[model samples]
Target chain A: MSDVFLGITNGVLYGLIALSLVIVWRSTSILNFAQGAMAMFAAYLGMTMSSHGLNFWACFAIALAAGFALGGLTERVLVRPLYKRPEINSIVVMVGFLGLLESAAAAIWSTAPRTLESPFSQIYFEHHSTTISLSPFALFQIISALVIMTAVGAIFRYTNLGLQLRAAALAPEVARLLGVRVNRLLTFGWMLSSAAGVVAAVVISSSGSIGLSPTIMDGFFVYGFIAAAIGGLESPVGAVVAGLLIGLVQQFLQDYAPSGISSFAPVIILVVALMIRPQGLFSTTKARRV
Target chain B: MISIANLSVSFGAVHALTNVSFDAAKGKITAILGANGAGKTTLLRTITGLEEAASGEISLEGTSLLNMRTEDIARAGVGHVPEGRGVIAEFTVLENLRLGSLAAKVNFQDGLAEQFELFPVLGERRSQHAATLSGGERQMLAMARALIAKPSVLLLDEPSLGLAPLVTAEMMATISQLCEKQSLTVLLVEQNAKSALKVAHDAVVLHLGNVVAAASAQEVASDERLRQYYLGLVDQ
Candidate 1:
C-alpha cells in the first residue's frame, strides 16, 4: 500500500516534468533537452537564496522568475538562428546547451551536491498501517503543474498573444505578414516553457531531491520524455496522462521489488509504446490533403 | 496606387527579376499573366515585403516602402493571399477569418454574416476546421480572409489553382464582383490567363521575368500574338 502511494506520488512528479516538455515542444517545435539543465540552474539559484536564510516560498518565487529569464534568453539567443532548419538540429543545440549549462553550473557552485529539507517535514499523516507523507513542497509540484498547464492552455486558446505564438510556430512567414511580431512570440514561448521548468524544479528540489547529481534531473528528464513520447507529442493532455501512468509504473516497480533497478521502468514503457504506435498512443492520424 | 521602380533581385547566382518596373493603378484589377517561373509571384511578394527588393524603391500612394519590416509593411496595408490557400488549416474558418482582421487592427466592418453572405458554403462551415474544407471553399476563405484585412490593394497569387473547373469559374466571378463592390485595387498573379484577363482592367504580360506587354485587359485579350501564345486554340 505504501508502495502504491509512493508510485502514485512519484508518477505525479514525472507527469509535471512531461508537461513542461510539452509546453515548450508544442510552441517552438524544439525538443529542449537542455530544459532539465535550465531547471537545475534555477534550482541552484534558489538554493543560494535559501542558504542565505530566505524562506522556502521566497526561494521558489525567485526560482520561477529566473526560469522565465533563462528560457527567454535561450530561445532568443541560442535557438533563434536554428528556426528554419530541421527540428533535429534544434535537439543537437539543446544537447550542446546541456553541456554548457552543466559546466557553467559547476563553475558557479562547487561540484559537491547538497540535500535540502522538505518544507512539510514537520507535518505527517498516517492511516492504519500505512504512512502517507503530504509535503508542502510536493503539493506545490502537483498544484504548480495544474495551474501552469491550465494557464498555458488558456493563453493559447483565448489570448491574441497566444494566437500569434501558435501562428509563428505553424506558419512563420504567414505570421510575419499578419503582423504577429514572430520574434517576440518565439521569445515569449521560451519564457513560458522555462517558467514551467523552474516551477517543476522548485517543487522537485523542495522535496529534498537535490544533491543527487545528474540523477535528480536526468531521471525526471527520461521519465518526462517517455511520457511525452507515449502520450503523443501533439496533445498536451496526452503528455500529462502518459507522464502519470509512467510515474505510477515506476512507483509500483519500486514497491514490488524494492531492490530492483528502478530506472528501467521508463525505458520498458518507451519501447512498448514505440513498437505499438510510433505516432504516439493518443495522437490523431491526420490524412494528407494534397 | 503602388509603384515599383528599378526593382532587382537575385537568388544566390540566378537573377529572378532585373530592373522590373511597373505601377498597379488604384481601384483597378491589374492582372500579371505569365508562364511558370516567370517571377510573377516574386514580384507581388517583393512589393508586399515577402521577398526583398535587392535594389529598388517601392511606394504605396507616394509613401516609401523601403526600410520597413514585413510586419510593418503588412500593418501599413498590403494583404497577400499566397498560392496553395494560406489559411491556417488547423484553425476553424471563423478563427482564420478573425486572424485576418487582426492583421491590420480594423475596428469593425464586415462580420461573420457578411462572410456567410458572400460565400454561403463558408458560412455553413464557419465552425469547421479550415483543413476540412474543399479546395474551392479554402480558396473562398483565403480571399474573404484577405478582404477582411481592408487592404487598399490585394495581392492574390494563383487563387484558383488546383480547384475544380466549375468551382474556379464561380470563384473568378465572385472575385470580380468583390473587386467592384469593395472598390479595392488588386494585383492578381495567375497562369490561368483566360480567367485573369476576363476580370482585369489592366494586364501585364510577363515573359522570362520581364514585362513584355503592358496594356488594357481588353487589348491584351484581343492581341493575336498573346492569344496564340496563352489562349491557343480556345481564342475565338
Candidate 2:
C-alpha cells in the first residue's frame, strides 16, 4: 500500500514534467531538450536564496519566476531565429543549450548532491493499525501538482488567452490572419512550460528520492519524454495519463524486478507502446484529407 | 478606405506583385479577378500584412500599414479569410467563432446568435468539429468567423474554390447582402469572374503579377476584349 501511494505521488511529479514537454511541443513542434536543465538551474537559484535566509514559499515563487524568464529568453534568443529553418537546427541548438545549462549549474553550485527542504512534514498520517505510506509532504506534493495541472488545463480550455495559444499552436499563419499575436503566445507557452518544470523539480527535490544535482533530472527527463511520446506529444491530458501509468509500472519494477535491470523498464514500455500505437494512446486517428 | 500605391512583392527572384496599386472604396465590394498565378492571393495577403511589400505604401484610413505585423493590421480593422478557408479543423464551430471575436477583441457576451443569424447551418453545427463541416459550410463558417470581428475591411481569398455552383451563387449573394447591410469594405479575390463581376462594384484584373485592368465591374464585364483576355470570360 505504501509503495503504491509513493508511486502515485512520484507519478504526479513525472506527469507535471511531461505536461511541460507537451506544452512546448504542441506550440513550437520542437522537443525542448534543455527543459530539465533549465528547471535544475531555477531550483538551484531558489536554493541559493533559501540559504540566504529567505522563506521556502518565497524561494519557490522566485524559482518559478526565474524559470519563466529563462524559458522566454531561451525561446526568443535561441529558438526564434532557428524557427523558420530545418527542425534539426532547433534540435541541435536545444541539445547544446542542455549542455551549457548543466555546465553552468555545476560551475555555480558544486557537483555534490544536496537535499531540497520541504514545507510539509514527511511523517505518515496516524490511522489506528493501518500505516499509509504517504507522508504529509507527499500528500502536499500530489495535491499541489494536481491543482496546478487542473489550473493549466482550465487556462488552455476556458480563457481567451488559452484560445490564442491553441490557435497559435495548431495554425500560426491562420492565427496571425485572425489577429492572434502568435509570437507572444509561443513565448507564453515556453514561460508556462518552464514554470511547470520548476514545480516538478521542486517536488522531486523535496521528496529526497533523486536529491539535487546538475544531473538529477537526467533520469526524470528520459521517463518524462517517453511518457509524453506515449501520450501523443500534443495532448497534455494524455501525457499526464501516460506519466501515471509509467509511474505505476516503475514502482512495480522497483519492487519486483532486479535492482540492476529496473531502470530499463521504461525503455521496454516505450518500445511496446511505440509498436502498438506509434501516434500515441491519446492522439486521435485523423484521416489524411488530401 | 484602403489605398495601395506602387506595391511590389517578390519571393526570391519571382515577383508575385509588381507595381500594383488599387483602391477598395468604403462600403463596396472590390473584386480581384485573375487566373491561377495571376497574383490575386498575393495582393490580398499583402494588404493584410502577411506578405511584405518591397516598395510601396498601403494605407487604411490614411494610416500606413507597410511595417505593421499581421495582428496589428488585423486590429486596424482588416479581417482575412485565407485560401482553403483556413479553419482550425480540430476546433468546434463555436470555438472557431470565439477565436474570431478574440481577434478584434470583440466580446459576443450576447451569445453568437448574431453569427447564427448570418449562417444558420453553422448554428446547428456549433458544437461539431469544423473538419466535419462540408466545403460550403466551412466557407460560410470562415466568413462568419471573420465577420464576427466586425472588421471594417475584409479580405477573402478564393471563397468559391470548391463549392457547388448553386452554393457558390448563394455564398456570393450573402456577401453582397452583407456589403449592403453592414457597409463592409470588401476585397474579393476570385477565379470565378462571372460570379465576382455580378456582385462587385469595382474590379481589378491582374495578369502575370501586373494590374492589367482596373475599372468599374460593369465596364470590365461588358468589354469583350478585356473580359476574354484577362478574366477568362468568353462571350456567351
Residue A241 accuracy (lDDT) in model 2: 88
Tell me how each candidate scores on DockQ against the true complex. Answer: 0.65, 0.77
What are the clashing pairs of model 1?
A: A7-A251, A11-A247
lDDT of 2 by residue, A179-284 (tens): 8999999999999999999988877766665678998887888888988888878778888888888888888789888885657777887889777877787866
- How big is the positional error of residue B2 in model 1, measured in Å on the Cα after superposition? 1.4
Runs off by more than 4 Å, candidate 1: A1-5, A115-118, A127-130, A209-215, A257-262, A285-290, B107-110, B230-236
Judged by DockQ, which candidate is best? 2
Docking class of 2: medium
* TM (B chain), model 1: 0.94
Give fnat for candidate 2. Answer: 0.85
TM-score of chain A of each: 0.88, 0.95
Question: Cα miss at B32, model 2 (Å)?
Answer: 0.5
Best by TM-score: 2
lDDT by residue for model 2 (B61-138), tens: 999999999988888889999999999998999999999888676777443788898899998998999999999999
Q: What's the lDDT for candidate 1?
A: 0.78
